[model samples]
Target: MSLSKGRISLIMNRNIQKIFLLGLLVSSTAVFSQIQEERLILNKKREPEVKKIEKKKTSVETIKNYPPEEKSAVPVEYEITNVPAVSDFKTSTIQGEDLSPKFDSELQKNYFRLGYGNYGKFLADGNISGNLQNQMEVGANVHYISTEGLKKEYPWSSKQSSAALGGFLTSYGESGKFNLNAEYNLIDYNYYGIYALQPAADVDLSQKTNQFTVDGYYDFYTNNILNDARVKSSFLGDKFDAKESNVSAMLNLSKHAVQLPANGITMNADLGLGIETLNSEFAILNKNYSNYFNADIAPKVTFFSGNSYVMLGSSFSFLNSKNKNLLTTDEVKSNKAYWFPKAEILYAATEEFKFYAGVDGGLKMNSYASMLQENPYLVSDQVIKPTETKYNIYFGLKGDLNQNLKFDVNAGFGKVKNILLYEANGLFDNNATLNRSAYNFANTFSAVYDNGNVSTITGNLQYYPLANLTLEAELNFASYRLENLEKAYNRPMVKGTLGAKYTMLDKKLHLGFKGFLMSEKPTNSFQIVETPNPNVSNSTIYQNVENRNDSVAGHADFNLSAEYKVHKNFSIFALGNNLMTQKYETFKGYKVLGPQILGGVKISF
Candidate 1:
């Protein structure tokens, strides 16, 4: 159950008053107790002495006391032994998730932007425009996230487990009629033990993930300066605890342009290769699962003009394996080919309206057999064929009314044929589920068939009534049909937000309030399967067996911030978020915390 905003506010106010009264009472009691203790001490009677005669006799006897002689002190020297050398060899266990280093060398660095440029008056004599600029960034971030849920013995846990240490440096020069640019990014990310939940009891999996990517590109243009060439490349590597390293790379070349006659155009061609060296333990699993090594080369091209465009592409892939236990595992390699083609058109009817439509068709090869061999399942067949073909078409419209209002609407329909699907056997079986499947899975391997059609529509609207107020709304609806299934499912989601901001004290202080509402139905097939198995076998029946009553969720966030500048480079500020103390749920059963406040100082130069 959730409380309304008004009720929560009232309770908070009452609690605040009670806290103040309790604090006052505690302070008064402490002061009264101290005063009583002091009074009791002052009331005690003091003793009087009667020793005049004794004092006179004692003084006479003390007059005969003599003084002692002074003596010189001697210093002693102590021998210091050489400290024994500490052993450099030490042993420590690398256990637990937090064992990784928290800091890196590149984290301590500053970035600067440099440039050189000139501008001159042109009048009617000549036209010229050019500039040179260089920019770079160097920084690292360490983030930690943990989550635990009910209905589970061992909490499902996942760690990002990464330390990305690298940066990008780029330079650019631009001139009229011609432009040139070149940039390179050198990045390395080391990932370890990033896992997802599986049905296996008391059994967890781990992997070693690392990747180094270097990207550089250049472009040149002349005459109308309508087009340019571009190139890109990337390399990736992964190592699982049970499997050795698998590395892959892709390189692509493309031509880019803006408004090629009627519209924009881009054409690209790519080549790729991959290699995997499996460890002994994983090799056994691969042999039983009919795993294979694979590589591919692809070429693609696209053309765009006016309100329409077209694209064509294809790829050739090769697979090889050496396993006798499974079919297609005895070095019985095969070559596969695929093709994709697409076309689209868009037109603007007026200043306030536009329309777009497009269709795409493609074939995709399956790589799951090689990708998921580490599981405890046996494979009856290793070489899964490519998807037959797929196509999609979409249309949309966007426009603006007046200066402060805008709206957009779009709809798309798609169909897929002969799509590749995974079939799992029993729980804990290597062939039961895809090793890489995260958060979405059903029982063990069965005869998996995939063919589906989907349609979706989305609409969004934004309006601003005043300079500081805005309102926005968006809605989406989608329906999906599996060719092998009898029934189609529909999902509808909606979100809306309204916000306003006001500035005061010469615009140095600002206050803002925003309210947002979101609602969605669990229309996903995976989510629906949580219900009891239906009696009907041929027809797909979706029954609403459970109602979490949390689909309708909303919250209001209020921000009160003030900034006071004390000097040219220093300022003090206070910021508070979620000041309304509203409580709500984000997902079906996930409760969100409320009401946080923060204040700090900022220095800038």
Candidate 2:
């Protein structure tokens, strides 16, 4: 009975264990199926679904994968992400901004100046300008200056007035740049080169001149070539019944063909061509018409090395001149061609030392208008010609002692053909038969041409230890020889200039002083001496005689000026001329005004 009960209990325990194991397996399978369904739903939402399509009667490559098609299903709730908004916005404010410190940017479009002082002196100057869209500029200016005669008896008063209207245009492009300018000027001048040797009486001498000018320039770059072109035209008219017209054109082209990097050298080939024409008409000089035409071509090669440079060039120039004398009904024509060779070399031994030498020559055209402009005292009776420069050789040394100091010394020898010079006429030859130019006797001069050679030496020095102060000095010495003249008339043997400028109070106050000196120059003069004629008793006759001097005295001039600013746009200025009260002569006998003082005001807008 005990063995039977033990077997039954063991059987019951086995059954219980089997039932528990079956229940646990069933629960685990249900949990795994639920977890798999949730994972499938999550993957469907997060990952892109792909579908494979089967093609009929195609190879393995024919099978293609396509994205899952859109389908409508029950709406499901999902967690939404929260993010911040982004924007690109800013805020700024400007109050006053201290524009005074930035006043340098302000443009001075207009300016005016007026002054008056003793000796009945007067000055008026003004200009107005405007910018057009930053591409062009237009402006107008007017100037007037006058001074009454001193206590002397001779006529020494003068008045000058001028007005100018101009415009400038510039175009900048990828290719290069172009500039255009047009200007018109009306000027009035007085013949004040008198009162030397005490004239018998005052003479009326005043002249009015008008000028119109137009100029254009273009600079272009293409590949390794640079091209430049310039054109200029001018029309000038004077009250002395003189009219002149001038035109000029120039073209320059250069190519940088060869360059050696190993030796640090560059070579450039340049070609230049120029043409000019001048026509002049003068009614006072026996009715004359003069025309001149000039053309030139230049070819050059320039070599630049580390510290040495050499330029080799030659110019072929052609000139044609035509002259007609209406009074004599005579016509004359002349044409010629000239060849000029140019060479220059420079060697920089060191940064502080340089040696340079060059030879150059050119032809200079002369016209009625040009001669009158250079010498206002020139008489209306004049002959126009072109000057030829045969050759000029120069050598110089220039260096800097320091950043604040610089010095230059140079010497040159040159020969010029048909050089123009001015000589006073009718010193004492009042008679028509005795005077060289009887038609021009009253405070007038004539132009004389000569062939001469000149030797010149010059020295210049500059010093600027401070930003506000600058000092400069220049000295020149020249010796001249003519074909058939004893001395070079009106040419100074020694000349020098000393100048100083200082600015203070932030450029509000400016001070300038200049001193000029010229050594004794050769000049011709005549003095009337009365001698009793042997044939005629007690009869006195005046004759012209050239005065011979053992020594000719030099002259010196000093001028000083200052300006004080009361405001940024306004100032008070003063000028003191001939401070030493030296009665010095600049041109033969014309003495400058002595000890003159002028004060004025300046304005800007």
| Predicted model with the maximum TM-score | 2
* Cα displacement (Å) at residue 235, model 2: 2.5
Model 1 ranges with Cα > 4 A deviation: 1-166, 173-214, 217-328, 331-334, 363-389, 418-426, 429-449, 462-473, 485-605
Q: What RMSD does each model have against the real structure?
A: 30.2, 35.0
Worst 10 residues of 2 by lDDT: 89-98
Tens-place lDDT digits, model 2, residues 352-404: 56677888888987766566544555666567778898998898876554335
lDDT to native, each model: 0.31, 0.55
Error of 2 at 534 (Å): 17
Deviation from native of the Cα of residue 141 in model 1, angstroms:
6.2
Q: Write the per-residue lDDT of candidate 1 for residues 224-253, one digit (tens) a residue.
A: 222233332323333432222233333333
